[model samples]
Structures are given as structure tokens and as C-alpha cells.
Target: MLTHPSDPRRVLVERSDLDPMALPPDLRRYEIHLRATFDWGRAYLTNPHPDLGRSGSVCPFVSASLKRERFFLAVHPGTPSDPAEAVDTMRFYRDWFLELAPRSQPSAQITTILVLFPDVPQDAVEPLVDDVQAMLKPEYVGQGLMIGEFHNGPPAKSGLWNSDFRPLRSPVPMLVVRHMVPTDYPFLRDDPEQARMYLELFGDQVPAQLRDQVERERAVGAP
Candidate 1:
């Protein structure tokens, strides 16, 4: 839940409109919530990589099943774009997630984060990824997971299709998800042969039980 600057429920911080940092306290707080939601989802669904902070213990990899839907989004819809905005946005989400974790089911002890980029270019996304790597470099080296789901064409375009899964080099253990599967069933969304190929390539990294689970899940209504 978030309060608005114009809303009487908030204490406004008078400042120039151009200054994103100067937004009213309530707006800023709301911005944090939006940011957190996007980050949580992006990190969990796209990149569940473990990151090491400049001062803290090593972050463990977040299990996808546990961190299914959490994230952060930009708060100010009309705010001007800023290069470092993503990082700031993620920071806010991480803090908020930590506070809200105890309240979530199964408890939010998992080390995962999500992010959403509205109006951000792929090139712009690279640097933010780098920053995240640095902030959590230790966790990313070997145990990190990076997943991405590119929508392919512009949102306005019709009849879009997700690309095949591909590997991306980003200084971390990545599980990049290039396509957005349409069906709830993995097999229906992805070609059986292709998915099998991927299983063959990375199956060794996953536990035997987990691999079996994937097979079982995909086998549902699968030819």
C-alpha cells in the first residue's frame, strides 16, 4: 500500500518537480513500494542470482518455487528517466521486501530480488545488471541464477512470439529465460525436443530430484 503526494494522508515535501529525490515523502514511499514490487518479480522470475553486499554475509541462491511472485516497479509514472534509477529502485525494494518478508507465507528468508523496467532500453539494462553483479558479486560467481523473459517485439505489436532460450554472459551463474511461455504448462509453452535439449545441457547442474520434477511437470498433457 502507498500514499500519494496530493493525498491529505501524506506529509508533502515541497520541492522542484524535476528533482525525483525531492518528491513528497508520501510519494517517495509509494515510489519505494512500486520499485520493490518490480525488483522482486524481476529478480525472482528472471534472475535469482545470489549477490554479496559490500558489508554482509554471502547471499544464498533463492529457490524459484519459493520466490515465485515478488518485485519492484518505478513509482513516478511521469518522472524523467535516469540511468541510476534502476539501482535506486532496487535498493528500495530490497529494504521493503526485508521488512515484509516475515509477513509473507513460508516467510521471506530466501535471498532473491525482482525488478521491473518501464521505458528502459536493453542497453540501459546492462549497466544495472553490472551494478547488481558488483553489489552481490560474491553470490553471483558460482551460485547465482540469471533469468530473462524478453517480450521480443514492441508491446503495441500483435502476434508476438518468445525467442528460444539462450545463454548470456554477465559474470554470474545465470538461468536466462529468453521467452515468455504462453501456457501454464512448460511443455505446451516450449517445444518438447528443445526443452529436452536444454535439460540435457544443464541437467547436471540441477539435482536429480528436481530434474525428475521438471520432467513430471512437463509431462502433463505433453505428447
Candidate 2:
């Protein structure tokens, strides 16, 4: 479903297409990272954990994405330490995500793209992974899309249910792109402009319990 065949910065691989034995030596690392982060790790993003507090799974949508073959992992061709290069690489995946098939409701919601930076040194993760996410997040929100940064480093953001638990941690440095769902209000609520954009996108569709919170945040106006 990847429309950008000419852009060679990354190679997109579907969850169902991952086969460690079949991959060449150079490409095998990507498969290993994906498996460790999403499969083998006990505290993986797709699996449910007791410490996760209220969650059924660390990410409720990942299991469905895997089963539906909608989960995609892109192997970045190089580990660019520059924030601008990282942002540009992510922007490529973002556009590819938007152009992917099954561009309809429900199905579209489960589709996600995780762009992996397997070679990025762990120490550089904060700037290359986290900072890039911070820079592109606003523009992504404006487009009704959500992007998240994940890495082997300590938790940057805590779980909603358990404050001490770092839910975003992963085995490899990566950026995830997915459609914005109504429940994502919590992420947007802290920023007035982001919150306003969420309200405009979801409006009455926002969950009844969170509607007041979104409106209140929006009322604060952009600072």
C-alpha cells in the first residue's frame, strides 16, 4: 500500500510480512527489533501487563493491527543524528501512512506505522527521537493524526492509569503514526491549540466523560 516507491529513506514492512529467517543479514536487524519491541518483550507495547493499571493491553489497538495486517514497521535506511533529518524521515512515513489503503472509518483507525531507527545510539534517542516528535506533533495534530516517540531510554511519559509506569518505552528508537481517536484527548488537553484542534476534529464525537475537559482547555485560549 506504500505509494511513495521512489522515496528510499525507509522500507515499509507489514507485521505479517516479517520473517527473520528469510531476511538477509543486513535487513535482519529490523525484524529482530520489531519482534523484541512488539513480541518477545514481556513488557511489550502489544501485551497486557499487571503494572499497566487500567489497560487491557499496553496499546489496545496493536493486537488488532497485527491480526489485520495493518501494523507496519519501516526500517530507516540510516541513523541520522540531526533532528531535522529525523523529522524529515518521519514526515515521509506520515505521508505514507495517510496514503495507505483501507482509508475508511474503523479500519483506518487500526492502521499504524512504526518507523524504526535500529542503529541510532541510545544516548542520542532523546534528541533524535523525542525532540523530533515534539517538533512535528503540532502539525500532525492539525492533520488529525497522532505521532509518538519510543525508545529504550527511561519513560518520557507516564501511563494514564499508573503514574510511575512508563508506557512509551520500547526496545528500539522509533516513531509511530496513527489516526487520532477520540480517546486521545488526554494527550492534546495540555496544549490549548492542540486541544482546540482535537475538539474541532472530534467535536460531539468526543467521549461524554471528557467533553467538559476538552472544552475547558480550549476555553483557556492559545498562550
User: RMSD, model 1, all Cα superposed?
Assistant: 15.1
* Candidate 2 local lDDT, 1-223, one digit each (tens): 2325775434666655558765545667667786765563334656788888885777877777878878777777567957888888888878878887334756899888888888887777777888888999999998889999888685479888888888787778888899998899999887878887888888979888787876676676646
Encode model 1's per-residue lDDT on 1-223: one tens digit a residue: 2223344442212112324465555455445434444344335335433332122221222334234432212232222265355435444443444444432346333433333343345454455444443443222212212233222221121111223322232222111211112121233224454444445445555445355657675688377
Residue 208, model 2, lDDT = 88
Best by lDDT: 2
Cα TM-score per model? 0.31, 0.87
| lDDT score at residue 162, model 2, on the 0-100 scale | 87
TM-score of candidate 2 versus the correct structure, residues matched by position: 0.87
lDDT of 1: 0.35
* Per-candidate RMSD, Å: 15.1, 2.8
Lowest summed lDDT across 10 adjacent residues in model 1 is found at 173-182
Report the error of model 1 at residue 160, Å.
25
